[model samples]
Target chain A: MKYKDFNHWELAEDAYFVNWVLRPNKHADKFWKQFLADHPEKSEDVLLAREIVTNIRYSDKPRLNDTEYNDLFERIISTKRSKRPSNVFYVREAQYRWVRYVAAVTLVLASAILYNQYWLSSHPSDEKTIQTLVKESPRGSKLTAVLSDGSKVKLNAGSKITYPKEFSDTLRLIYLTGEAFFEVESDPARPFRVKSDKVNAEVLGTSFNVRAYPDDRKISVAVAEGKVKVTNADQSTVRFEHTLLPFQESEINVQSNQVVKRELQDDMIFAWTNWKLVFKEEPLSLILKKLERWYGVEFELKGAIKTSETYSGSFDNDPLKVVLEVLTSQDAFDYEIQGRKILITSKY
Target chain B: MKVFSESSITSNGELKKTTSSRKLSHQEIVQGLEQGDESVLGYIYHRYVQDMFGFGSQFTRDRELVKDSIHEVFASLIARRQSLEKIRSIKSYLFAAVYHRIIYDIKKNTTFKNKNQKNNYREFNIEFSVQNRLIMEESNREKLNKIKSAIKNIGARQRQAILHYYYDGFVHEEIAMIMGLKNAHSVTKLISRGLKAIRESIAVVVVLFMTDLG
Candidate 1:
């Protein structure tokens, strides 16, 4: 049927016309282009109908925020892990069910221990050591410290480093929560170890960054020079250990006990040292997490962001609004800032 | 419904690209999922979970149940990723899968005490608003209100059909799959009928307004 005679309202009501207006594929575009050419007088009707279809905003649906989405995604991914082919040792269907139950119990216990350790480490009691010096970088700032051993430590925002004023001849140990870049002096006689809640990185004389924010489920160590050994320090009997040379990084998932080691590009591992935040095709959720840590702001996402969606850009000391505006420019989302909180939602 | 045109100009004047660019297509995502790629799975979750939650919530007001159903759907998709055939419309397939899972869960949890409660579940209702200031002029206020009421008065199934077609950008066949209709033709008919109802209502309102003016 010829669409030329249809009024603007009729065209708007037509499913095909509405589809063309909202999302014109190649075929739809071709057809509409030809139709406009054939009946130039109907262009206004078509445009008006298109405007109506495009502007009609539907009621907002209840959506899971970024935190909720990430939480649910973690659950889904972990559940998948439990059913992996490698776990086929529990081949019998009934036995598989039993193993899952046992695994669930073990997970609960493991996480509880991890949480306890994180709490204790973050709030180390005053009675523990009189000689220890604690340096803290409040939100929106970085702190640098020189240990007695001549090692340099650059603490990220909202991070704290606790170490002894004088290093023992046996070992040089420091505790960190949040993120830090360390340039340890080469002392083969005494290996240096940086401990976080979930993992420990030991080195003889190497520079590396350790990110183990208490709220983050994963701990990452990116080595910049020399060799560093990373080991999962959770109280679980089965431990994970990995060694990283220069230009290597390892991430340990605290909950699933998964370790991922990969080669690191210079920009990927060390950009934050230069006061720049670089994300090489990272998910919006992970990017949000990093932004929260760096800027010490709360981010609340209001709509569904596709799992396949990723963003890649670098920001150097940009305001939170500028960074957000740049990120949301390509995606059909909008962001608003209220004090220290940013709310992001899909734009209608 | 509209196909995802990847070339639309974004707010910042940059060309929009799909989350799944050349490096990550639907097939690759499915393959990654089968290979237990955590990031890929996470990407899929970010993409569809909210819409799935919204659709599932339509069947039941139990928010917990809806969340559970969505979780189960993703878990199952991951488990079966290796066996799944190439998916044509990932969005539609996901919508259908989540819809069926929610219905199954609701049926399994049905009880005599809650049997009547099922009737209390609200039908799908779409709130239409005109945001264009030009259209919001005083002259168009009556017409806008009429359109809004007309939308509100449409049948539940019709409203759902329109929502899936327009807002969700699902094709007629996909809408049919999500709604469990017989075929795509049925979806087309449902939408046309719904629009016709709205048109008739608006016509009546316009006639009454004109008569009052005369």
Candidate 2:
């Protein structure tokens, strides 16, 4: 029967009406409201039908209890865990293949230089002392290093850390570029200082992340676990500095020397440490830059992007192509990838 | 092969590949699983195991068997992720995979004692429950039971379409994919027909009640 011919009881039995009551969305709400307004007499029928649809109970469908679900989930995870060793082996194999090639070349050169210095009767006493060690993470990878004072530093992609082999009695200092998370060993007598190009972060016994990429317009410091003192390192007329507490972040604009401080959510600031990327309403320009550094690829923008265009999203260990696909899906853009470079253009 | 070799080039080349592995989407998780990433396998399990188990239970009363089928489907997905084609909807793909596994298990065990089980497996059914607080009158309760039975009397395909669409909250396209229909049009037809039958049955019950009351 046509919907117009149906009485209140028959309207109540209509599946579309019942489904609308079960799960109402914007469109459904509009349609039902319009229907009620068009046929005021059917209002009681619509209400009764909704009641009937919501009241029908199906007792025959099989159900899995919560305990069963949890048990099954654990079993599946355990099965994957049992197979993890082989996966780890493959990762190690892939890592070592490159490490071995680099190590071999460096080892041969080092041995030749050492032999020349010792056996050629050179005055070794005049040689410069190698009192500092420099550790760098390439464009797409992160690197962790242990300082002589037992503190650990995690360097983000395309970053570097230079530290002394031995700490001085007065202070423990490390030079940083790009970004790094520092877990300083507690020694109240000696302050730990990280000197980046644009900013210097000092702490007594705390952990924090400092991001000071040279080309970026701003430098930011986020405190994760402890307090930190951040000061402008640039030799400019006006300097910006701030003392950041736990879950606090400070950003210093390089061009204007304006400092902005605010409370930060742990996930937003420290997701990178767990290998996740979280961007909240960040400009497309900044997102692309971060993606370029994280993926080790060059992004050439071929079209104009509005300055106000921003994207907020998070990803946890996805390939570059997939991440690019998701980003472009939202905006009107097309991208082409060639070897190590990606060209993004307007989708017109 | 070229990708692997490129990853071993220099620190610069390594950095590029390393960054690519930082964040994962659903598609990436599938790709990672294929590449023998145990973490991705764990991720897929945690994300969809409950939904899969609920859907699988419809085919059989054996909860353990349903659980086993879910486990087997995921294990096989991990084992075959490398060769598995790109899936458009992870949810529908998983539902279809688990559905096939349960059907196969049922067919395999169709012995003399399992003959009744075969009949039960052939028909798709869902349990519906009304909120206890909403049932205020005896006649309303009677009307609800009539509608529930009417839903059962509809064709199996119609019942499956309604259950998948309404109860499971799957879109028409996803329901079509899961139910092996030609397209979403078929699913829409099945659901409408099922609802029509229920309406007819409820109308008859309503007339009988009114006449008896008079």
Candidate 3:
């Protein structure tokens, strides 16, 4: 028999032997017991292997007492999230109260929309008709808002999201500009649709980021959790449609109407939502561009703009001055900040 | 109408351990779940919350996040009950669900960066060892240490593969699906290499122990 040539470790690794040890049957039990009895010399190896299979265990698990388990079940069964004035970004709210929510929403959104009158003039939506609320995060500052539907949005600096105060029975739609990370509450019946400048993302339930900064050439949608279906805007006669799973993202070019899908390189894409600045092997020009939105400063580059050199570091929302110091130290450039203007002159 | 197999339900598979014959099988629980019976969610949650918490904590240390992910997994499973007919093993399906959920949570929900943050993301962490009683006995101390040291020498991925296979009662394809490998072929290679490492590490001890036994 093949068992004659097997060592203890091989016997332990063997599936047939492991099955006998883990899930014993009468037939295999009799066969293995007789094998051990007949081959006394191989008994040691067989016993040793059996021990190995039986002994492997992970660390002890976290167990709830009887009370906690019962409470957890009760909590999970109910419509758990009751949206009662949750703080921004830390929103675990349940859905309730349409008029009161719209009141609070109008306070933040009315001023925000009016403040960007020039930007809104292009679309010129007659506010009396549809009744949509818009929130815009000013340059150099992020804003978090919990929608009436209990979905959460973390708007990046210089970004805006126009959403209805109360979603219709059939659909929940929102419009976006610049970039925003959304933690959409899953409601399969009413699909959450985020219509950006030139791209639209439709998701039943998901957490994803949509970047459609007007200045940027490409509109990108990156999924942190769940799935997102991204497509080109109606302006494009040739429709673009693609579904992105977790840790996957899509980029749609404005001019070309091109759609590309790729794996998310790192969680750094989510750093902004967490209030972190994590740069992983990023080019110098791109770094400066992010710094502009982060600090509300414009870079006036003189002598040479070093686009080739790359930088990598993580900062916990460091001040602009300190960040500039660290950045200039790595490259031969001197940056001077004067009234929200950053002047950088490359030495090399 | 297929009854649950022993191997599939081996991970605390029975609802209650009574020979009186009222014990609910895994298949029945799933069937009830598919039939819009919300009560099974309670059984499933109470039955597997501890295991789910334990498995999820391996990926991310946040206790609340793990609990929340567990709730979401069960909640979402109920939300899509119509798709339950195809699931073979509820344990593996729940585990895979929790695994994916916690991982996705880790990607976005991680607010602070501790030193372990670099090492903690997107990895199935596990520890391997011989049984406690065997390690403590006087006669087997040296031999068991040798065996454990060899097991420790296995890589993290290999250790996870082994844990899924032996402890969790997952076949190669299931392990492959859980670990996000391409197929069972890769999982087979990973297990073989891991066993080979342990074998070479403990060959001398096995021989020495065999001689002592003789």
Candidate 4:
């Protein structure tokens, strides 16, 4: 450093000295403290230099306003999105969801096979996939797949489905972690079964929706066009079984091992298939959770939410900002959007 | 100073590498850059926008031109990410890239503007912020006054070299690349010449401080 002859002006302009003053860490502190101890005569100059650098500010510092920042951010993101991998098979998102998902979501579909493979290989303990084909959707993206049996599957966000590229002659089976809608091709000889954690839905030839996210307490199987046989996925001695017809939904309480059945006026339980968020008198907390996966954003509530109250609204392929604005319009809350994160707060 | 053991303090010319990590390593950023990771690009943008803007403004007065040049630098960085040549320092690379892009824009538009516009804008302009930290002390103010005069006395090229070395926290090697100098030895020479001017002024302040104490 030749710092013995270097005065405070020269010391203040030293790159290492300025870095120590501005961006301090243990190593920098140690280095400077040692310098002070070694050069007691120069300590006064070093201290004055440190003070100058600490208070130094640039005069012509430029900044972009919120609108300008977001405009530039979007422009750059759009430029990158066009160059995203356009191959279909590599994208683990649902084949049908890609259409509406592209129109509504922030991220355009890119093949996650390579990204997912990297994740899967790194995380070997998380129940390795044995199936020939693995289809997965990250938060905020939906994927579609057509099984070898001609059955079409729409995989929801933060979910994974594993099935053989070619189904075996004996029986067709697929494992589910999150939620998915299946339109099983009629195969009388080989039954199509959706094996989940709590509920196993077996159908001969029909279309149905299964909600079995690992975090959810209840796993439900709702039949839309055909009969579905629901059975306990647990391989214990006492096996529970139930059959559900069209317009019927079966909720299996995972903790209680109890089964509840309900009838709907219409088989529109799968409104999400059309990219519609339908919540009829649903609690605000639950609605926010659904919005997180739908828009692929995180919501941080600042104040106390009126948990006693329930919300009922249907957002059909609306942007997340609109959905949040509409939700908090009459309610006691406010919202702020930054990148993929949204902060929602209650007024009182 | 001779190379202080950088094993703990500063890894010269290495961004995102430190005894205290900035959470992203150079290898990780390069890997993410190749994959067109927007978050990595965003991190780099947020980290260096001020420096980039300041560096870009030195060449031209048009704010939009500076912004466009900044945008083009990032766009090209991403477009050519897969085959990007080795980038030693992201900050210096962006600075040099922005410099070239603004120059190119200015060159193309020289038809409408005067032919001497290139020479007029060829200078590196810098002004230290007048934030008074030593406002309370007379001798501290005198110390600052000497520095102001010294900065005024230094050559134009030496001022730019000092700015890159001190204000931007760039090592001599990175400053060499950014300033298009032949090598780091020249960068050290340029900075030392500038520092000597400032040091001489500070010496006069030291003599004044002794007399004031007496």
Model 1: per-residue Cα lDDT over B1-214, one tens digit each: 1121122222211111223443467887777867778777666765777788887777677655676677767766766632566567777888888887777767656787876565435446676554443234346677777777777888888888878876788888889888889999999888888767765775676676667669
lDDT values of the candidates? Answer: 0.66, 0.63, 0.65, 0.63
In Å, what is the interface RMSD of model 3? 18.8
* Candidate 4 global lDDT: 0.63
Misplaced by over 4 Å in model 4 are: A1-32, A51-57, A83-348, B1-22, B120-153, B199-214
- Which regions of candidate 1 deviate over 4 angstroms? A13-16, A84-348, B1-23, B116-122, B130-146, B208-214
Lowest summed-lDDT stretch of 10 residues in model 3 chain A? A99-108
Candidate 2's displacement at residue B142, Å, is 28
Docking outcome class, model 2: incorrect
i-RMS for every candidate: 13.7, 15.9, 18.8, 17.9
- Judge candidate 4 at residue B25 and give its lDDT: 72
* Candidate number of the best lDDT: 1
**lDDT by residue for model 2 (A1-348), tens:** 255567654564455765577778898798878877887877766665665455443345555543344445544554454332345544533322221110000000000012222212222442353276789998899988888876667788887777668876657777666777665655667887776545667776545566656667766776654357777654661476677755567776656666788876533665565466767778788888899889889988886755357777777646887777777776678889988899999876
How would you order the candidates by DockQ, starting with the best? 1, 3, 2, 4
**TM-score (C-alpha, index-matched) for candidate 3:** 0.50
Chain B TM-score, all predictions listed: 0.76, 0.70, 0.70, 0.72
Report how far residue A254 has shifted in candidate 4, in Å: 71
Local accuracy of candidate 1 as per-residue lDDT tens digits, A175-211:
7776777756556667777776556677665455666
| Candidate 3 per-residue C-alpha lDDT over A1-348 given as tens digits, one digit per residue, 9 for 90 to 100 | 889888877888787888888889998899898888878899878877887777566644556543334434643654233333433422322221111110000001111122233224323453344457889997899998988877778788888887767776667777777778776665667887776545567776555566656666556667654456776655542377777755677766555656677887655676666566667777777778888888888989899676767777766676888788777765677988879998999787
Q: What DockQ does predicted model 3 obtain?
A: 0.14
